[model samples]
Target: MRESLRLLRDELSRINSPDELSSWKERFEELLREAVEKKLGVKCRSPVYLFKTLYHAGFINREELDALLQFDELNDPSFFERLLERLETRL
Candidate 1:
């Protein structure tokens, strides 16, 4: 999960404000679900819990975490990875 955490760290750094960070939570949630499923080889029953795990693991802060879970968005893994890469450097 080192790669995943690294990716999350990169993504978090890209967040310019709490607002944008919140928006990303939804997308990040989806990404987290997919990753969890792939890594565990099973479907996750609780997306909320999964999101919380990711949040606590360093994907985002409390304010943005709430927003991201509340927001709705599509998942673009490539874009997400790129965002993470950009944010990592910025951070």
Candidate 2:
């Protein structure tokens, strides 16, 4: 794990293009969402609340949010709540 992290850091340090950065940014977003889902059970009740939590955690920003949530459409609290609830049921 440490070696993988070191390689990822090296790759990030050499990133040279907006496109490359954007791709990495998307992967980062997915990982972050996964982590949040795992840790918090995805019970967010509002987009604002989710956004605030992610922002506070420094896991996202304006551009990433715009891309990931497609300008906040995916921020639907009901959707996240349902997703978490479903995962909980499965567990």
Candidate 3:
């Protein structure tokens, strides 16, 4: 997970336009889902933290964030709510 995030960060640094950033949104979402699934058993906070980091870094905008949150695989409304609350505070 840390390695994936590192790769994402490195890729983000190379983004030269809005198009490039837009292209990465799905990759970020995939990473979030994978991280969440891998850590689901342990109740790890990595997924939320990764979202926050991507958001703060401008790798994703509000719309993308919402889209990512809409993932049904999470199957946890409270977790989504908590992440939404965290995002609101950051905004």
Candidate 4:
């Protein structure tokens, strides 16, 4: 998971156009969905860890990180919905 997130961060850092950014956002949302589904037990921490890592690494700004972290306080069932909503707004 850490490796995956790192790779994503690397790709995110290389993005130079809006199309690339949009693609990245789609991939990110997919990753979040997968984590929520397959890593049910780690859902709470995994996404937060990845997002925080990205923020600290300068891949994402403070505002984006804060919005993503908002899911931390949400119930498990609402995680995907909230994340999708945030991502849509970002796009």
Candidate 5:
């Protein structure tokens, strides 16, 4: 596992293009989501609670959360709750 991580780190260091980096970022996010699902026994696709938990844990960054929720509010609890309700309805 350490060897694999070392290799991955070396490869990441050599990546130069935005397109390539973006591809890698997507893959890493998918891997993290899969691990989270496996550990929590929840399908992360439609679970706002799980996503919020991850965000609070710093496992998911603000930019990633914004993309998922289409929300930009940082400290507005009421607004965030409303958005979560709206998004849940869309599911």
Candidate 6:
């Protein structure tokens, strides 16, 4: 789990465009689900809750949290909504 989070952090730091988000979001959600369902043994609603749960569990640190926060929210809200809308259409 630690290794998974580390890989996520590294990949997150490299992402600088929307071209990367769809794939990255899938990996992030999968890892969060693994951490919550297996490691932490709980259900998670949103990514924020999953990450904060991991942070409190010591699976993630402050810097990692900041990286995740920036990745998740440092953008116009509609941009992400549109991205997710488009992504959902493929399902």
Ordered from best to worst TM-score, the candidate numbers read 6, 3, 4, 5, 2, 1
Estimated TM-score per prediction? 0.41, 0.43, 0.46, 0.46, 0.45, 0.53
Q: What local lDDT score does residue 45 receive in model 4, on the 0 to 100 scale?
A: 43
Name model 6 segments beyond 4 Å from true: 1-17, 73-91
- Expressed as tens digits, the lDDT of each residue in 14-39 for candidate 4 is 77776776677657656755544454
User: Residues 5-63, candidate 2, lDDT per residue (tens digit)?
Assistant: 33444555656776665564444345445556666667455445555566555555554
- Predicted candidate 1 versus true structure: per-residue lDDT over 24-52, tens digit per residue: 66555556677656654545567667656
- What lDDT score belongs to each candidate, Candidate 1 first? 0.56, 0.47, 0.54, 0.55, 0.49, 0.60
Off by over 4 Å in 2: 1-10, 43-50, 55-91
Quick one: best lDDT, which candidate?
A: 6
Best by TM-score: 6
Which pairs of residues collide in candidate 5?
A: none
- The whole-model C-alpha lDDT of candidate 6 against the native structure comes to 0.60
lDDT of each residue in 1-91, candidate 6, tens digit only: 6566556656666777775765777776776666567755788877777767767776556766665566655444343344333323321
* lDDT for residue 25 in candidate 6, whole number 0-100: 75
Distance from true location, Cα of 80 in model 1, Å: 15
Error of 2 at 84 (Å): 25
Better of 1 and 3 by TM-score: 3
What does the lDDT come to for candidate 5? 0.49
Question: On residues 1-91, what C-alpha lDDT tens digit does candidate 3 reach at each position?
Answer: 6666656666666777656665665575566656554654323355566555555556457765665555434433334345434433432
Ranking by lDDT: 6, 1, 4, 3, 5, 2
User: Cα deviation of 32 in candidate 5 (Å)?
Assistant: 0.8
lDDT of 4 at 52: 72
Report the C-alpha displacement of residue 89, candidate 2, in angstroms: 30
> What ranges in model 1 sit over 4 Å off?
1-5, 49-91
Put down candidate 5 lDDT per residue, 30-77, tens digits, no spaces.
Answer: 544565675555567744565675676555567656654643223333
